[model samples]
Each structure stands twice: as structure tokens, then as C-alpha cells.
Target: MNISTFGLGYVGGVTAACLAKGSHNVIGVDVKGEKVEMINQGKAPFYEKDLDNLISQAVEENRLKATKDVKEAVENSEISLICVGTPSNPDGSLNLDYVKKVCEDIGTALKYKNEFHVVVIRSTILPGSTENVLIPILEKASEKKSSGDFGVCVNPEFMREGQAIYDFFNPERIVIGETDKRSGDHVAQIYNDIHATVIRTDIKTAEMVKYVDNTFHAIKVTFANEIGSVCKRLGIDAHEIMNIFCMDKKLNLSPYYFKPGFAFGGSCLTKDLSALLSKAGELKLSCPLLEAIIPSNQEHIDKVVELIISQNKRRIGVFGLSFKSGTSDTRESPVILAINRLYEKGYAKLFEKGYEISVFDPNLDKSDMENLPSNIVPLLSPSLEEVVEKSEVLVIANNDKDFKRIPSLMREGQVLIDLVKVIEADEVKDGEYIGVCW
Candidate 1:
């Protein structure tokens, strides 16, 4: 495969060197004469571990070359990868000037080329940046339809700064966001011999994946630092604690608590978080991430209330009264708070309005159900069908297997408010299924 890369910056420089090592003919294109001259001389302009050696070897083998001319680079390759920087503004938005300028140059070069060329963006960008910004620039510059005359894709790089060369050669995944299937296939073929998992998705999703990975990484770093601060104050080794925490493959340091669902309100999580923050407050320690846990939990509960209020239906059925499934405890349950808010909102009582509200918990003890509100009619029904049949809008506050089956029993116009992502609720077409934190 013949590859031409623009910018000759961090991403482009690394990509050109690595792709050349993979036996692809690579042309490094940039506007800076110094960067182009350095590449041609088999020297890395930027400082990176093992990058100099890779460039020297690729240049020695005649597999990599550098040029300041976009015309020459595009004429020499079938694919053009845009690796220009998308730096940040002071307000934290992306600075897309570099990306736009490179796209214009590529689009103009593309108009003169006869063969179909693929334009792959390896730059980190926000969602819709490709379609909303780059595609328009390319279309306007070339005066031709994007998919008709050429191919476009958002193949975001997942390389860390110092280890970019290694990360490029050994990536965890290869994500290709294409405007069309043909573009996807063309981009996918470039990594056909690589060991990474290939993901072909829509353009927007691919664009968003880079931001998600980066933001999550930032959160993890901050979380560890804040935890370390508290551990240091207590004369404990935070590293060892996190090491043990990371060892719990079943729960901690795994995908166990990473699901996008309802906020946590169990006896253990809620109580422990409050207790830790209280201790932190006594020490006068300002742990933003730690202090934010409870408030974020409250915000999640508030979202559930808003969902219920949005329906404008006063007759609401609240299922799973406990903080979680398989528990008789109702302490700090968001569902409990939601029900209280409904009471204050002037909704007629279930018995008074002659509209039945059923609460079913297969795992709950008989005593727990009997102790609930008098207006809350506790049903001994073992199945979810009874609950779905009784309510105009069903709210699933737990991931109980029985409750997960309610989507199948949904009647037309009935709303299923899901606090737990138990089923394929997003794809269910029977009725309006709303996830509290999807």
C-alpha cells in the first residue's frame, strides 16, 4: 500500500515511520522545510523513544520519503492520512485550523489526481468534526462529491506521547469511521496484517471514541491522585491499596462498575462514600473527585424524577423499592426519593384516584412489603407481567432478572423507565423504554 501523510507532526511522523516499517511506501508531507529536510535526512525532528532509528532504517530501505509539496505526495500515494494537530482553545474547545488547512490542501491535490484516494483522519476530533467541517472543506475545494470522487474516514490514533511508535505497531484496536462502506473496506485493508481488533462504525461514533478514551484516562489519573492524597494523610500506602484494588478482576479495576446505568445507592456504596468524605472534611482535605460522589448521586436521582415528571402522568408505578435487588433495605434508595417527590407534586393517591399502583419484589420478604406506604399496594406476583399490566408507566429500579423481562410484556403507549440496563431496552420497539442513565 502507498501512504501519504500530512503535517509531519507527532501523529504523522510516527505513522509514516511505522507504516514504512510495515513495508508500505510512505510519503511524509509538511509545510515546514526543516521538518521535511530532517525526515529526508533520516533524522527525527521531534524527540521520541526509538523514533530516530525507525526513521533512519525506513529511509535507508527507500520505503519512506519526505516532501513539502502536497502535489508530489498525493501523486505518489493512493491514501492520504491527515495527522495534523487539533489543539485546544483556552475555553477547552478544539482548534481545528490545522485540520481545515490540511484538508483544503488535500482536496485541491485530489482534484488533479486521477486515481481514487482515501483521506483518513488520524487526528483526535470531536463528534461531527469530520462531516461538519472536514467534508465540507474537501467538497468545496475539490468541487466534487466526497464519496463519488474519493473516500473519507476518521481513523483516530490511540498513541501515547513517548510510546507512540510502539502503540502504532501494537494497538489494542483499529477503529475505522467511514462515510461509506467502500471507504471502510479501503481503510480496513491497510491494517489487514496487524494484530489489533478492527472496529467498523459510523463516522460520529469513531470521532467520539478518541474523546471518551482520553477523558476516561484523565478521570482515572485524577481518581488515583485523590485517593492517594487521603491514603497519605492516614499513613497508608496508596500504591499498595490500588494494587490490591486492581487485583480484584471480578469487580474492582474491571468492567464491573463501568456500565452506563443508574447511580449507586446501596447500603455499602452510599454509606461508605459519605463516611469517607466526612473524614476528608474533618482533615480539611479538598478532594474534588471524592467530595463529588454524593452530589453526583443526587443529580442522578434528580434525573429520574425529571423523567417521571416529564410523562405528565400522575399515576406512576415504582418497582424495586430496595436500594438494589435481593435486598430488603430501602436506605437512601433513589426510588424511595422519587416516590416522595411524586407525593409532593400533588398526584392523587393510588386508592383515591381508583388507579392501581403495584410494587412487586420477588426477592423481598413479606414483612418488608407490609411495612411500605399504605397507598403502595404490594403485590405477591412472582412475575413482571403482573407489574407491567397494572401500571401506565413502569420504572425498573433494579436489574432483577424478572424485571428485565418486562420489555417483552410492554403494551402500546405504556412507558418503561429503566434505572438498570438489564435488557436490550434501547432496541425494544414495543413501547417507549427510557433508561435513567444510558
Candidate 2:
């Protein structure tokens, strides 16, 4: 494969060298003549371990070259990889001027090329930029349609500096966000020589994955540092504590708490987090991320409440009042808090007009009545069917297996707002189904 890599910097330089070593003829493009001259002389443009050697090897083998002309680079290559820098703006958003300029250059050059070239964006961009921004520029400049006259896919690079070459060959997984199957398959073909987990999905998901990966890394670092501050105050070994905490792969270091859904509200998470925040306060430690957990959780609940209220339904039904499924414990359950707010919101309308809030939880029995809030007692329905039949809006607050049938049972004009994704969006076509965070 003849590949043209735009931006002969960190990502682009390493990618050009590494892919060239993989037996692909890589043509590196850059506006800077220094980088082009350095690559052409069989020398690395920047300082990355093993990068110079790879570049020298590829160039010596006649598999790698560099050029300042985008037209000549794109005209000779079957694939063009955009690895330009998207540095931060003053307000912390991505400044895409470099990316846009490169796209315009490539689009102008692509107009003359007759081959069905694949344009792969390896730049770190936000979701919708590829389909909404770059593709439009390419289509307008080239005067051709995507996936027909050309192909485009987003293949975000995940290489750390100083370990770029090793990371490229030995990645944990490879993600290809494609507009069409042909484009995805063509992008996947480039990694045929490497053995790694390859997942092909839609363009938006692939674009968002890079941000999620980076932000989660930031979250992990912030969490560790905050806990380390608290540990240091008490003269405790933070590293040892973290090592032990990381040993529990089943729950701690695993995907147990990673699911996207409603906010967490249980006996353990809230109580423990609050205790830690209080301790941090007492120790005079400023842990912004730690302190924001409870408020953020409440914000999620408030968002759900606002969503429900915006429907303007007089009668609302809530399924599953427990903190989660498979439990009768209503202690610190987010749904109970939401139910209280809904009851208060609805009762105010009772003064002006008429409104009702009904709830049903399979785990709740006579013994659980004392565990619920005082305001929600009158709202509890005897049976799920009664709640479903009487309500104009149904809210699935937990992932109970019984609530899966609610979508099939929905009637016209009724709306189902799912907090835990108990039903698919397509399942409730008779009426309307909305997921809280989907």
C-alpha cells in the first residue's frame, strides 16, 4: 500500500516510519521543509526512541519518503493518513485550523486523482467532525461523493511518546470508525500484519472512543492523586493502599462500575465517598473531583426529573424504587429521591389542576414500607399493571427484568423514559421510548 501521512510530527512521523517498516510505502507530507528534508535524509524529524532507526531502515529500503507537496503525495498514494495536531484553544476546546488546512489541501489535490483513495484521519478529533466537517470539505473541494469517488474513515492513533513504535505494533486494540463497510474493510486491511483486537464501528463511536480513553486516564490519575493526598496526611502508604485496591479485578479494576446509566446511589458508594470528602475537608485537602461526586450524582437525578417534568404528563409511573435491581433496600436509592421530587412537583399541579405519581417495585413488600420516604407512600401502586394502565408517562428507574415487558405493553400517546436502559429504543414503537443517557 502506498500511504501519504500529513504532518510529519510526533504521530505522523512515527506512523510513517512504522507503517513503512510494515512493508507499506509511506510518503510523509508536511508544510515544514525541515521535517521533509530530515525524513528524506533517512533521519527522524523528532526525538522518539527507536524512531530514527525505523525511519532510516524504511528509507534505506526505499519504502519511506517525504515531500512538501500535498498534490504529489496524494497523487502517488492509495491511502492518505491525516495525523495533524489539534492543539487547544484559549477556552480549552480543540483548535482545528491545522486539520482544516490539511483537509482543504488534500481535497484540492483529490480532485485531480482518479483512483478511489481512502482518506484516514488519524488525528484526535471530537465526534461528528469527520462526517459533519471534514467529509463536507472533501466533497465540496473534490466535487465528488464520499464512499463513491473516495472513501473516508477515522482511525485515531493511540501512541504514547517515547514508546511510539512499540505501541503501534503491539496495541491492545484497534478501532476503525467508518462511513461504509468498504471503507472500514480497507482501513482494517492496513493492520493485517499486526495481531490485535480490531473493532469496526460507526464514525461517531470511533471518534468518541479516543476522548473517552484519554478522559478516563485523566480521571484515574486525579482519583489516585486525591487519595494519595488523604493518605499522606495520615502518614499512610498510598502506593501500597492503591496496589491492594487494584488487586480486586472482579470489582475494582474491572468494568463493574463503568456502565453508562443513571447515577450511583447505594449504601456503600455515597456513604464512603461522603466520608472521604469529610476527611479531606478536615485535612485541608482540596479534592475537587472527589468533592464533586455527590453533587454530580444529584445533578444526574435532577436531569432525569427535569426530563420527566418536560413531558407534561399528568400521571407518571416509576418502575423499581430500589437502588438497583435484585434488592428491596431503598436506602439512598436515587429513584426514591427522584420519586419524592416528582411527587412534590405533581402535587403542586394538584392545586392548579390534577396530577398523580405512582410507583411499583417487585422487591417492595410490607416490611419495606418503613424504608421508603414519607412523601412516596401515597404514590406506591399495588401492582405494576395498575401503574402502567393508569399513568401517562412510565419511568424505568432500574434494570429489573420485569420492566423489559413494559415496552411491548406500551399504548399510543404514552411515553416511557428509561434510566437504566431496560428497553431498546426500537422496541416501543407503539408510543415513545427515551433512554436517560443513550
Candidate 3:
């Protein structure tokens, strides 16, 4: 395969050299004469582990070269990889001037080219950037439509600094976002011999994957540092504590609580998070991430209240009042908080105007029912049919087996606000159903 890389900096330089080493003909394009000259002389422009040797080997073998002319590089290569830098602006937005300029140059070069070309963006960008920004620029300049006259794809690099060469050959996953099947297949051929899972998706999702990974990494680091600060104040070993925390693959280091659902409110999570934040406050340590947890949870509860009030229905029935499914504990339950807010604020005026609210939880005892407001009736009926008969809107708060039967029991006009997604999406009427975080 003939390949050309733009921006002969860290990412571009490493990519060009590695591709050439993989036996593909590579031509590196850059604005700086010094960088181009260095690549042509079999030398790396910047310091990277094993990069100098790889570049030297590729150049010596005549598999790699460098040029300042975009036309020369584009005409010679079938695939052009954009590896330009996206630096941060003073206001924290991405400076895409370099990216746009490179696109303009490539689009201009594609004007005279006759063969179908594939442009793969390996630069880190925000979601919608490839379609909303890059594709339009290319189409306007080249006077050609994407996936028809040419192909466009996004193949974001996951290489880290210092160990880029090793990471390149040993990637955990390969994502190729393409405008067409031909473009995806062409880009996938670049890693035919590499052993990694290949995921083909839309261009925007591929662009967002890089940001999601990096942002999660930043969050993990901050969370650990905050925990370390609290531990150090109490003369505890933070490293050992984290070591034990990471060992729990079932929950801590797994995808247990990572789903985008309702706010968590069990005895353990709410209590532990509060204790840690209070300890951090006592030590005068500012753990912003830890401090934000409770308030964020509160905001989610408030959102549920807003959703309920938006329907403009008076009669409301709630399913599962416990903190979670199959539990009787109501302490710090998000559903309870939402219900309280709905009664006190949402239906304050409506309650006196003959509006009704009822709750049905299989686990709810007469003692647990005492916490609810006087106007909101706690149903003592064993059958869920009775509760559904009296309500205009139903809220499913937990993933209980009993709640799964509510969809079949639902009348035509009744609205469902599901926080647990107990029923399949297709089983319910489209506009009548709403998920908390779907």
C-alpha cells in the first residue's frame, strides 16, 4: 500500500516510519524544511524510543521519503493519513487551524488526481468534527463528493509517547470509521497482520471514542490522587487501599456501575462517598471530583422530578420505592428523593386540587410507608393491577421482576417514566415511554 502522512511531528513521524517498516511505501509531508530534510537524511526530527532506528532503517531501505509538496505526496499515495496536532486554545477549545489548513492543501491536491483516494484522519478531534468540518472543506475544494469520487475515514491513533512503536504494533483495538465500505476495507488492510479487535463504526462515534478514553484516564488519576490525600492525612497507605480496591473485578474494576442509568443510592455507595468527602473537608483538602458526586446525584433526582411534572398529569403511581431492587431499605434512595420533591414541589398546588399520587413496592412495609407524605397514598394491595388502575403516570424506579408486568397492564393514555429499563424498548408505545438515560 502507498501511504502519505501529514505533519511530521511525534504522531506523524512515528506513524510514517512504522508503516514503512511494515513494508508499505510511505511519504511524509510537512511544512518545515528542517523536518523534511531530517527524514530524507534517514534521521528522526524528534526524540522517541526506537523512532530514530525505525526511520533510519525505512529511509535506508528506500521504503520511506519526505517532501514539502502536498501534490507530490498525494499523487503518489493511495491513502493519506492526517496526523496533525490539535493544540488547546486559551479558552480550552481545540485550535483546528492546522487541521483545516492541511485539509485545504490535500483537497487542492485531489483536484487534479484521477484515481479514488482515501483520506484517514488520525488526529484527535471532538465528535462531529470529521463530518461537520473536514468533509465540507474537502468537498468544496476538490469539487467531488465523498464516498463517490473519493473515500474518507477516521482511524484515531492510540499510541502513547516514549513507547509509540510498541503500542502501534500491539494496540488493544483498531477502530475504523468510514463513509463507505470500500473506505473501511482499505483502511483495515493497513493492519492485516496485526492482532487486535477491529471495530467499524460511523465517523462521529469514532472521533468521540478517543476523547472518552482520555477523559476517563484523567478522572481515574484525579480520583486516586484525592483518595491518596485523604489517606495521607490519616496515616493510611493509599497505595495498598487502591490495590485492594482494584482487585474487585466484579464491581470496582468492572462495568458494574458504569452504565448511564439512574443516580446510585444504596447504603454502601452513598454512605462511603459521604464519609470520604467529609474527611477530605476536615483535612482542608479540595477534592472537587469527590465533592461533586452527591450534588450530581441530587441533580439527577431533580431531573426525574422535572420529567414527571412535564407530563401535566395529576394522578401519579410509582413502582419500587426501595433504594434498589429486592431491597426494603429506603435510606438515601434516589426514587424516594424524587417522589418527595414531586409531592412537595411538583404537585404542591395540584395536591389540594384533587390530584392523586400512589406508590406500590412489594418490599415496602407499613413502617417504611410512614416516611412518605400524608397525601401520597402507599398502596397496601398485593395486586399491582389496583395501583395501575388509579394512576395516569407510572414511574419504574427499580429493575424488579414485578415491574416488568406493568407494561402489559398499562392503559393507552398512561405515561411511563422508566429509570431501570425493566421492559424492552420495542414492547412499549414510542412517545408514551421515556427512559431516564437511554
**Model 3: runs farther than 4 Å from truth?**
348-355, 358-394, 401-416, 421-433
lDDT of 2 by residue, 321-387 (tens): 9999999988899988887776656545643666677899998999989877787787888888999
Please provide, for model 3 over 135-165, each residue's C-alpha lDDT reduced to its tens digit, 9 standing for 90 to 100.
9999988998999898999999999998899
| TM-score (C-alpha) between model 2 and the true structure | 0.96
lDDT of 1 by residue, 79-189 (tens): 999999988999988899999999999999888888888999989999999999999999888877888789999999999899998898799999999999988888887
**Top lDDT hit:** 2
Off by over 4 Å in 1: 326-329, 345-357, 370-383, 425-427
Backbone clashes per model, in order?
0, 0, 0
What is candidate 1's CA lDDT for residue 341?
66
- What lDDT would each prediction earn against the true structure? 0.83, 0.90, 0.89
Pick the winner on lDDT between candidates 2 and 3: 2
TM-score, prediction 3 = 0.90
Colliding pairs, model 3: none
